[model samples]
Structure formats: structure tokens, C-alpha cells
Target: MLEISRRGQAMPVSPFRKLAPYAELARQQGRIVYPLNIGQPDIETPPAALAAVRNADIRVLGYSHGAGTESYRHRLAAYYQRAGLPVVMEDIIVTTGGSEAILFALLTCLNPGDEIIIPEPFYGTYTAFSIAAGVNIVPVTARIDNGFALPPLANFERALTPRTRAILICNPSNPTGYVYRRAELESILGLCKAHSLYLISDEAYREFCYDAPYVSALELAGAEPNVVVVDTISKRYSACGARVGALVTLNKQVYVAAFRFAQMRVSPPGLGMLLAEAAAELPESYFDESKAEYQARRDLTVARLQAMPGVVCPRPGGAFYVLAHLPVDNTEAFGQWLLESFSYENQTLLLSPANGFYQTPGLGSQEVRLAYVINRTDLAAALDCLERALLAYPGRTEPPLTTTEVASAFTAPLLTQLQ
Candidate 1:
């Protein structure tokens, strides 16, 4: 028998797309399925950026420099510098996408058998990437009681083992949408500096930060040598198909190491660089409309969840996701039920089960992470399906708090934030 390598078997399947087959079946059955499962935003790519690639005068779409073309890197570096991060063209290594940049960072920063600590429920693919890098992940679980804020700095300290080589954070986090405030960023950076560990900051959602200003790890006074930022044009400009992302660091050695990995892939997509370079030139004000749109979606998702009986949803500070605690005991079953057996007016919605996002067993069993990337109409429809599904689910139970109790818990903090 041809055997699968242990590493291959060990890679965690992405929850984001694992249920795609179910979605296909629902479509086959003539049910309209709205996807709230993944972060694929329904926003159109900026016309100007698409035009850049369309108008390119290329005779041969050959390989760019492994560090990306000098022109693209220069432009991208300027975008970073304008945001108050001190960077230059030489400090970047362009890769396939933010996903590739993550792989590069993990490979470059840690040795085999090393460990990296991350807060859960993080971008779930981090586990798959760590498995590929031959590193162990020490997860500090964040809770929904306080809106999934980074598990306290003390928790990070306690999880540290001798093999721990780095700490990775997704500011304006994915599953929780809990943007790291100044105090938290500073404290986490101080801890990293004190321990001489590399800090990988995945700022892919920087531009979408709503309630608070986005802060880059690169902006910290002494973060120059210890920080590597994984950035992408995919989420920034709704250009996920472009597959253009960069690994940026002021650490000369780290940049050099990552470049070697970039070279092994030959080069990033050439046309992607063209599109990204043009996107980089877009005005800072370009984000105004898009940001507002996502914030509105976030608000809608949170309010709907909060109003539902037996549901608890804390308003997220930023990002387009809300990790809502459902009235069911296990979300995986409920999620499958949404596609397989349940429907509202011939409609179904796809869900990303929160359990897959947690590496620790038994955690997040009652949760589901919803990405409000669709338009208001589709999103509202999905939530309606969700409400009806819960009522009809065989295993549904009264959640810990009533709708009033959950709504009141969010009122004080939300009011203070607005004031």
C-alpha cells in the first residue's frame, strides 16, 4: 500500500472549506445557499486595480525577482511607511499570498521541534502551517465573556516553554474581531522583547479596523529587528484572486532567510505584482467606503445574534467576523444540519463550526464563527435561516443567558466605547 506520510495525515483540514461539499449538494437540490462560513468578501475588486493588469504591456509574463520586482516593493514599502512603519524595498520578500507569507515566516523563524504560542481561536489555518513547519503550537485560549480579547499577558507567560521561539498575533483578529488596542500591543511587544522572541504580526485586516486605529508591529519603537508582518492585497483591496502578499521585516537576516524560501518557489504570480503595485497607489481615503460597509455588516450581524433567544454575541471592536455562542450543545452537528436537513423557504446557510478553530478539545463546541462578508440582504437571510434552524434543531437547549441578559451585558461596554 502506498502510505501517506505522518505529516500529511497530521495537517488539520480547514474548516472554512471542509463543508463545501455539503454546500454543493444544497445547491444541487435547488436550495439557495448563502455563505457565512469563510472570509471571502463579496466586495468587488477595485476597477482601477483590475485595469492595471488588463493594460499591462507584457510580452512575457515571466518571473519577477524573488523579492518581487523592485518597482512593486518600492511602492509597497512606501504604503507601509505612510502608515508610520519605517520600511524600505530591501526589507520585503513577496510570496504567493498572505498564506505563503505565513509559511515563510514560520519556516524562517523556527527550527524543527520549536514551539510558537498563539491566541485561540485564531485563523484556523495556522495549525496547518505549523504542522508543515514541523513546529508545535501552544495555544492561549481567549474567551467570549470579554469579547475574546487576547488571553491576558499572564497567560502567554505561563504557556512559555524552553522550546518557545515566537508569538504570533492577528491584530484585528479573525474569528473574534477583537482588535488589539495600544495597551495590549505594547504589553505583548514588551513581553516579546524581554524574552528575545520573534513576533509575527499578521495585519491582513489592518485597513478594516473600525472602532480603533490600526497599529502595526513595525511601529513599535524597538520592534525593528524582532517583528515580521504578513500582509496581503487580497483582503486589503478585495483582491484575493491576485495571490500577492509580502513578508516584511527590518531584520536583515530574517529578510535574507525568507528570500531564499521565496526563491525556492521560483517567483510570485507576475500579474499579481502589477495589480498589487497599482492597488498600493490608491489613496488612503479609498478605504472609507469599504470600511464603513464592513462595519455596518458587523453591526447587523451582532445585533441580529444578540436579539435571538438563547444566543450570546458580544459586539466586536473591528473586523467583519463575530463568534457567536449558539443555543446548541455542538455547532458541528448544527452546522451540518443547516445544510443537510434544515432550510427556511428553500434557503440554507453555510457555517464554520467554532470547534475546528480551537485546538484544545471540548472548547468552542457551542460556538460558530460568522463572516458578514455578504450584502445586507443575503446576510439577513442567512441569520433568519440560523434562527429557524436553532428553533427546529433536535439538540437545541436554552443558552446560559436570556436574550435580555446577553443584550444588557453588551450595552455598558458598547456605550462607553461610543462615548
Candidate 2:
């Protein structure tokens, strides 16, 4: 038998997709599955972005500059400048996607066995990425009860160690949809500055910030050397397949180091560069309609979840995701049961088990993250399936029977699994 690398063995699986085999089996059995598990947007990719590929004259499909095409970088820089991040083309290095940018950031900023502080229930991929980069993740737990707000400065102070090298955050976060207040960002940046630590911010969902203004890590005054932003066009333009993202920094040293790593990969995706440049050309007003649509969907999702007994969902300020506690014991088992055993009107729903989002053991066992990316009609249908499933779910830790439920001996026994 061949031995595998220890690092490869330790890579965490994606919570969003880990149950895909169950979903496939459900589909094969003729059940319709509405996957609310992943943040793959159902919104149409901008026509301009698609056209850039369809209309391009390049026959060779050759490699672009390792730092990405200079023209594309300029386009990205201009787009950032409008967002109030004062960056030039030289300040950015395009990568295959946000994942690659994160890799660049991690590899450049921290040594193997060094630690990067990240809040709990963060983007799940960060765990895999850190493992791949040979870095240790130090999680400062943030409570779901507080809408996943940033833990206080003292929390960061307490987590610090000699091996700590950086902190990573996702604004309008991926799983919980929590947007960091500017003051929170400042305080975190102050911690980084005080400790001479790097701050890597994943701003992929910036455009979808619904309630409050999105604050980029770049906005903090005089912390250029301490801040690095990882960005992507996936969610912004509904162009996940484009695979274009950037590592942005005003610090010359970090930029140079990340660029060197970029060269080793030859270049970022070529066609993606074209697609992103086209997307960057889109007007700022484009986000307005998209934001409104997502905001409405977010409202629909939260309202539906809140109405369910024993469900606790905090209204998130931004992003298209909602992290909610269900009445179940282990959400992974519950999610699998939804695909394997339950259906309403021949329909089933897929959900991301929230435990995979946390580095802390057993933290998200009772939670699930739902993405409200589908349009209202489909979203409504999916939520309907979820509600009925929860009412009938056998794995729930306790009965969530209501007055109406108590009135029905039918619902009461099912809620308690007494049958």
C-alpha cells in the first residue's frame, strides 16, 4: 500500500459539498433537490463578462503575465479606487481565483507551523487552505448567539502567542453573513499593528453588503504594511466559473513575495483575466439592482427560518448566507437524512452542515448554513420543503412542538420521534 502525505490526509472536506453523494442518490430516485447548501449564485452572469469570452479574438489562448495581464490589473485598480481603496496596478497580483490569492497570502506571510488567527465558523476553505500552506489556524470563537459578531479586542489579545503571524477575516462573512463594523475593523487592525501581525481579509462578498456600508481592510488609516486583501469576481459579477481574483497590498515587500509565488504558477487564468476586465468595466450602479434582489431573498430566508419552532436565525447585515441553529443534534446527520429519507411534495433540500465551518471541536453541530441565492419562487419552494422536513425530522434533540402542534397528536409524536 502507498502512503499518503500527512498534509493531504488532514485536509478538511467542504461542508457545502460533502453530502453531494446523498443528493445525487436522491436525484436518481427522482426527488428534486434544491441545494441551498452552497453560495453558487443563481443570478445571471453579466452579459458583458460572458461576451468578453465569446467575442475575444485570441486564437492561441496563451498564458498571461504571472502578475496577470497589466491591462486587467489596471481595470481592477480603477474599480478598487472607486471603492475608496487607493491602489494602482502594481499593488495587485491576479491569481486563478480567490483561493489562489489566499494561498499566495498564506505562503508569503507565514512560515510553516506559524499560526494565523481566524474567527470561528469562518469560510470553510480557509481551513483546507491553511493545511495546504502548512500553517496552523488559531480560532477565537465567536458566538452564533451574538449574530457571529467579531469577538472583542481582548479576545484577540488573549489568543496571541509567539507563533502568531496573521489574522484572517471575511467581511459580510461567508457562512453567517456578519458584516464587521468599521470600529471593529479598526480595533482588529490596531491589534495587528500592535503585534506586528498580518491581516488577511477575504472581501469576496463586499458588493452584497445589504444593511451597512462595506468596509475594506484597506480603509484603515496608516496600516498598509499590516493589511492584505484577497478578492474575487465570483460573487460580485455572479461569475464563479471565471476564476479571477487578486491579492492586493500597498506594502511593497508583501507584493513582491506574493508575486514571486505567482510566477511559479506561470500566470493566473488567461480567459478569466479577460472576463474580469470586462466585469470591472461594469458600472457601479450594477450592484444596486443585484443588492436589492439579494436583500429581498435574504429577508425571505430569515423570515421563513424565524417562523420555524426552535430555529434561531440572526438577521445578518450582508452577504447571501444565513447561519441558523436547528433543533437537531448533529446537522451532518440531519442534512444527510434530508437527502436520504425525507421529502415534501417530491422535493428535498440540501444544506451545509455548519460544523465544518469551525476549527473548534463540536461547535457547529446544531447549525446549518443556507444560501439564499435562488430566486424568490424557488427559494420559497425550498424553504417550504425545509420547514416540513424539520417538523418531521427524527434526529431533533427535543420536540419543538407549538400550541398548534400540541393540538395535533400527529405532529406531537412525530416531533418527539415517539412513533
Q: lDDT (CA) for every model shown? A: 0.88, 0.90
**Which candidate achieves the best TM-score against the true structure?**
2
**Could you tell me the TM-score of candidate 2?**
0.96
TM-score for candidate 1: 0.94
Per-candidate TM equals 0.94, 0.96
User: Model 1: residues >4 Å from true position, as ranges?
Assistant: 399-419
Which candidate number maximizes lDDT? 2
Please write out the lDDT profile of model 1 over residues 1-419, one tens digit for every residue. 99999899998779788788899999999999999999999898989999999999989888878889999999999999899888999998888999999999999999989999999998999999999999999999999999998788999999998999999999889888999988888888899999989999999999988887888888888998789999999889999999999899999999988988888989998999999999999999999989999988888888778877789998888778999899897888888888899887899899899887888888888999999999988888888778667767788877345567545653423211110
lDDT of 2 by residue, 1-419 (tens): 99899998998788899999999999999999998999999899999888998999987988888899999999999999999888999999999889999999999999999999999889999999999999999999888889999998888899999999999999979899999999999999998998999999999999988887889999899769999999999999999998999999999999999999999999989888888999999999998889999999988888888877789999999989999999987899999999999987899899999999999997999999999998888888888788777777877778556757644633332221110
Question: What is residue 387's positional error in candidate 2, in angstroms?
Answer: 0.9
RMSD of 1: 4.7
